[model samples]
Target chain A: MNTFFTIVAGFLLVNIAAGLVRVYLGPTPADRMLSAQLFGTTGVAILLLLSQALSTPALVDAALVLGLLAAVAVVAFVMRVPQSEREADEE
Target chain B: MSFAGLVLDGLLALSLPVLAWRALSARDLYRAVILFITFGVILALAWARLGAPDIALAEAAIGAGITGALLLNTVGGLSRKNDKDDERPDEPTDRVGRPWRTRLAVTVPVTILAGGLAWAVLSFPAPVVDMPSLVGEAVAEGEVSHPVTAVLLDYRSYDTFLEIGVLLLAALCVWSLGLSAVRSTAPEAVSGSPVLAGFVRLLAPAMVVSGVYLLWAGTSQPGGAFQAGAVLGALGVVMVLTGLLVPSLGRGGVVRAGLALGFAVFLLVGVVSMLATGGFLAYPEGFEYGLILAIEFFLTFSIALTLTALFTTVPPREKGGGA
Candidate 1:
């Protein structure tokens, strides 16, 4: 059980590391921005898994906070960074 | 720990330095900032692995989330201003022109100093005193149920007091160097995005609820004023960037008062308590919990206001940079 959760979390981290390649080669800045979106989802998943594995409910609250604030960077990216190689004004 | 757990911890430990190196060594500023955000996310996980959930929340919110937004905002502004040069991959954001010998000259002594510090830390002995147990007993006597809360508020409140003061001072410094006007307009702002604005409006409630929950949870759990404040401040940044807020608003009396409220309330409480207890920030025998909660409450507001003000640092509107 705990071991299962830990491994899952570790794989998620590895998943993020794998996603780093896309960040480098994603051409447009908007495509690069998806890395942050990946982090928000994967980071919350990791935190939630760790909370269950470690039996510390505090980490759930951390996950909640992470889930809530996850889109902030995306919003900032959309609102601030003007579309350079545009697909749809801010693609 | 099991082998799987060990592997997970190992991945976290190894990746931190690797990610940091990548962020620093990246040629493009945008990539560097993006990598830095990724590093912050992993850093929060590391803190959680160390069983520090409070720091984890703060790091996730402030270090990873809001800081990423702020950095991205700066990157956006820089890219907008310098359209020609930065877009090119060949032009590095910064070029280290120093010769290899000069770099080696600085690197050698710094590496030795870092090694010496690491060695000293590794060799350090366990404490003669059992500080955790002592704190446990003291926390039992205090109003706050949580050990971290007790230490932060009842046991060593002066640090929290001075921290709020420093926050105020930081806001002051940023205000003095007014920088709000130059990059106020955004493509989204000019071409109105009601969808984003509606999304933000929807987010406001969740942020307020979570922030209050963090502050309230601090009495018994890992959530605290700093974490709560950070959530609110991030909300502030979102609103400010959306043009729902005037960039020059931080200079207004209402916002300044909100900024000062935390420090003022804290000092007033401290002075009142000191007059009775003969020590600043000392609470009455049974009134400790209430005092700590009140202080935490105000500190949250002050911190939130200060952080938002720092983010909203445009040149004063009167001399507005023609935005």
Candidate 2:
């Protein structure tokens, strides 16, 4: 069962890696920021799966911390790099 | 390890370098910062696979969350400065003007140095010493059930004490730089959206509870003061970004005291222990857990404040115009 969970987690991680291509090829900062957000959600899933696979309940706490704080970077991005500024940079 | 575990580890290890290379080579500063956050997450997973949950927690919280927020803020600040200076916002201003020959000259020795270090690490022999056994024997007298916490707060607390001092020193250095004028330009305050406002309101309490729980759990599990501090610091970053807590408020007496509280309490505890027990940082017998928890509580507050202040570089104005 643990092995099965680890395998599923590995597949999710591969999906995350695929998502990075969008960030790399982004035409806008917003696109890249979205990719980072995807990473945050995927990371929480990976941590959760690993916690179960590894039988170390402490990892769940790490997941909780990540989920709670991951959106912060996006908030910073929005506040500091406004939509107009990103659009302006494109020109 | 099972086949699945091995494959998972292999994929994680392989992705780390790829993410790191892309982060470094990305032309867009924002892309680079985002990629760096992804790299940090991968690295945290690697730490977990290596059986260091404490390190994994800290890496995720501080390495990814806090550092990503700081980088995003910095990139924003730089672009804003560029706008004021009438420079191209897309172009990096801090690019070095060294010739390719100079770059090659630096790269050669750096490569050789890195190779030598890698070789040394790969060649290291398994320690013949029974350090774990020694620690195990000694840890019984300590209050904490976790070995890492026992080592950090009881066995080798002087190092921890000095680390808190270092954090305090860093905050002091940033304070000395004086407030930058650019902070006043922070987006129209509170984002003009009710959803974000409600989110911040809801998340703030949850983050506080998580931070406190992580600190308390450190006595027996993989959480600790540093991890808890980073969580709280990230909370502060989120609140500040939402305009809920202005940077200038950090200049107030209460905030300043909070910033100093960790180092002060730790130092006081050490000195008192030295004077009374003839050993620095030696908790009185039967009260080790209580003292360590007390120290950790104050340390968490100070760390959170210091990290928040470090990111918010502007002092609060007397007029209180901004949020």
Check candidate 1 and list the clashing pairs.
B179-B313, B179-B314, B179-B315, B180-B313, B180-B314, B180-B315, B181-B314, B181-B315
Cα lDDT tens digits, model 1, B26-97, are 866677778888898899999888898988888898878888887877665554333333455434534747
Q: How would the docking of model 2 be graded?
A: medium
Per-candidate RMSD, Å: 3.5, 3.7
Give the Å shift of residue B185 in candidate 1: 3.9
**For model 2 chain A, the run of ten residues with the poorest summed lDDT:** A82-91
**Which portions of model 1 show Cα errors greater than 4 Å?**
A85-91, B80-95, B182-184, B187-191, B314-323
Off by over 4 Å in 2: A88-91, B80-101, B123-125, B181-191, B314-323
lDDT of 1 by residue, A1-91 (tens): 9999999999999998898888777666676679768988899999999999999899998988887777788777776665542223221
Q: Write the per-residue lDDT of candidate 2 for residues B1-323, one digit (tens) a residue.
A: 99988999999989998888878766678888999999988888888788788888988898789889888887776644234446544554337477889889988999999999999999999999888888887776666888888899988899999999899899889778876633524455565677777888888899999999999999999888998998898888777776667745557788888888998999899999888899999888888999999999999989988888877774433342332
Query: What does the TM-score come to for chain B in model 1?
Result: 0.89
Consecutive 10-residue window with the lowest summed lDDT within model 1 chain A: A82-91
Enumerate the chain B TM-scores of all models.
Answer: 0.89, 0.87
Global CA lDDT computed for model 1: 0.81
